[model samples]
Target: MSVLIKTVGFSLGLTLVFTGVANMLPQVEGDAPVDVKVDLSALTMDDFVAMGEDLFNNKGTCTLCHKPAPLGRAPDVQGTNMVAITTERLADERYQGKATDAASYILESMLEPSAYVVAGWGKKGSDDAESPMPAVDKPPIQLSDIEVDAIIAYLQAKDGNEVTVALPSPDAAAEVAKSDAAPGGAGAAPAPAASGEEGLAKYTCTACHALDSDDTLVGPGLGSVGARLSEGEIRQSIIDPNAVIAEGFPAAMPGDFAEKMTVRELEMIVKLLAEKKQ
Candidate 1:
């Protein structure tokens, strides 16, 4: 009986020790990836261009790799004219794919990135050169066709080039909305905002704008925006950014904030930014 008691006590002590160790260790949690969906039916050509500019600067992550200035990793978008580049590339014997025009060339670049690997950017010594650029329609980016159209429009308009594609009608967008409501649809509802910081992170505001410093990243620093612009102007900037762009910054603020942000979330962000006068 004494032996049995000793064995049971030893087992209990071991179990307690294991439980304590488990509690002391850090807990790691994995979150499922969120799908982003935007309804573009109601947006006009101007709206699309604006949204595209936002995606380019933020969600699209284009600026992370491509820059206006010449860099070793990726091509410079600002210095070169895309229309002229596309026309010239079509005449190249090394060029592959069915892109016949400037618009198609841009579309092909996004869709089939590996089709034409730009010189010096491709994988070295491989029989078929591979491009570092991932397909924008695939994972990590997963931009919708409407979003793609908007980005293309942005690229065209930014250089003062002619916009070749027309935006879809509102009725067509309504049809898309209806289809999305059906079983196994691609569309997802907007994410809930827990706080102003979460809302800013959700829309990827930190990717371009900085709160801590006056130095610009992609957009103007918001460190002193509260001192500069009124609350109403700040609110307008969130929804309609191009209305008044800050000096020394490109008018590339995303125009989809009105659709992406809830009224409460927008107010929360605006209030937080308004407090950043210093």
Candidate 2:
């Protein structure tokens, strides 16, 4: 009986130690919640544009993926003339929304990013059928409706296009607030899954490259990156994106992925990407 008790105690100690070690390890996957609010009443078009520019650079995280010039990872916001294209998309057979003009079209893009993906940037395996862009109003980068409006205004004004949406009055803003506070009012959408391949989607990698095919989106299709680069090279590319920019691609990849990814998370992604081969 004494020997049996000692064995059980030892097993319990080992279990506790293993549990502690597991807890101490860094987490490689999970979703972080975001709670954001913004009020756009009583601001001028200039104010909206200014606020929009700030948000784009900082809060919106737009500059992380988008650039003024065409980068293989994402679209060039400036070079593409987003405002003008928004208006043009209205006549496109792929545009399924009721946006009659540029402002509404831009808003639709923000709210329903997958509705109309730009060519060469769609999800893989679908023949340019789906968009990889996350809804701006969704999690990980949740922007309120008014904030979205400001971004549109900024995109328009910066590109020398006409800003169509006027700022709301204080009374109108108050009414919007009331509606939001009411039952069944504005609420956050479901957060994206944060593990495995879904984790890649959560990070919006599909925005630029496909995982399973060689079809180039904005960046080189990562279908067979392992065949071309070593594991160390793959990790380096994520940590120091410009270290070895692939040929025929701009060195516009964001350099902050190292700060955003955990060591284990980096390993997972590298392993997945390495499996791709011609």
Candidate 3:
């Protein structure tokens, strides 16, 4: 009896120690929880891009719902051109600092989708407007304002013409600081754009193209497309998709849908694609 009691005690202590050790090791794979410690202020463009990629691929888990468009919508990473969808609309001066860019708009769309309902895309027959992107502002997925800023910067860079971002000038920063102190200063992030141009990819574009920054899928990744095509070229590509087929890519983009899609929708989709950048 004495030997058996000693053996049990040893086993219990060893088990506790093993569990504690496992918890202490920095993020283990598979079963381990992620330990993100990104310092936004110190991050370079590369770092920001990496973090944005991480958010898109892993942590924020955007792929789960807003997948690339080709396969089909929802529950699949099919045809979504998220990069283009995010850029063109954010470029509008009206978006300044408030869903002003693709990243911010995506963040806003992620956190609050109901504020601006995308026409024809709102949840059918719902009481209040319902957004498809789930709310991720709670607990583990909670995003800090600075992190949100980094994400916006990253996406903007991805969509901008492969050029270095013009960092906010000191004067702009000072104005921002002043605004932060004012009433409702830089208040809660604005709701995402319900404008058809901004909302198209989220609703239908992804149904045919992938929207990721680093990879290709049903459709090619639109990383630096902006650098290669003019607005007119992009417009023509959309209205007459078969006119210029991207090498190694199928011209399988549904052309017969010209009748199904309005000219405005075609223009918006084309313009969005023209904005991709690495």
Q: For this target, which candidate reaches the highest TM-score against the unseen true structure? A: 2
Q: In candidate 1, which residue ranges exceed 4 Å CA deviation?
A: 1-42, 70-72, 124-128, 175-278
lDDT of 3 by residue, 36-148 (tens): 54433455677766666666555554554454444222433123344566565465443333675444566676567554444334443433255444455543345544445
Clashing pairs in 1: none
30 Cα displacement, candidate 3 (Å)? 4.6
* lDDT of each residue in 119-152, candidate 2, tens digit only: 7766555666766566777665667676787888
TM, every model: 0.50, 0.55, 0.38
For model 2, the stretches where C-alpha displacement exceeds 4 angstroms are 1-42, 168-237, 242-253, 258-278
Runs of candidate 3 exceeding 4 Å displacement: 1-33, 39-41, 70-104, 161-278
By TM-score rank, best first, the candidates go 2, 1, 3
Query: Which residue pairs in candidate 2 collide?
Result: 72-218, 72-219, 224-276, 224-277
